[model samples]
Target: MVKVATYFAMTFGAFLFWQSMDRVHVWIALHQDEKKERMEREQEIKRMQAELMAQAKESES
Candidate 1:
């Protein structure tokens, strides 16, 4: 009975450890995705700014 109890405890510990790692992995994935989206938004903003500048220059000339 003691050995069975020990085995159960070790298995539970391992399960908890694996679950924590899974959470970490999910968080990292979400962070990376957000970073990628932010970069894309920045690029769009830059493109829009350039277009506006060009329009202004044309109007001045």
Candidate 2:
């Protein structure tokens, strides 16, 4: 009976550990995706600003 209980405890602990690890992986993935999106947005903003500057110089001439 004690052996059976020990086996169950071990299995339960493994299951819990696996679930936590899965959650950590998901969080990391989401954080990376957000970082990528932010960088893209920054690039776009820089591009637009450069375009505006070019147009202004052309109009002045």
Task: Provide the overall lDDT of each model, using Cα atoms, as 2-decimal numbers.
Answer: 1.00, 1.00
Tens-digit per-residue lDDT, 1-61, candidate 2: 9999999999999999999999999999999999999999999999999999999999999
TM-score of 1: 0.91
User: lDDT score of model 2?
Assistant: 1.00
Q: What is the lDDT of residue 28 in candidate 2?
A: 100
Q: Per-residue alpha-carbon lDDT of model 1 for 1-61, expressed as tens digits?
A: 9999999999999999999999999999999999999999999999999999999999999
RMSD, each candidate, Å? 0.9, 0.7
Worst 10 residues of 2 by lDDT: 1-10
Evaluated at residue 44, the lDDT of candidate 2 is: 100
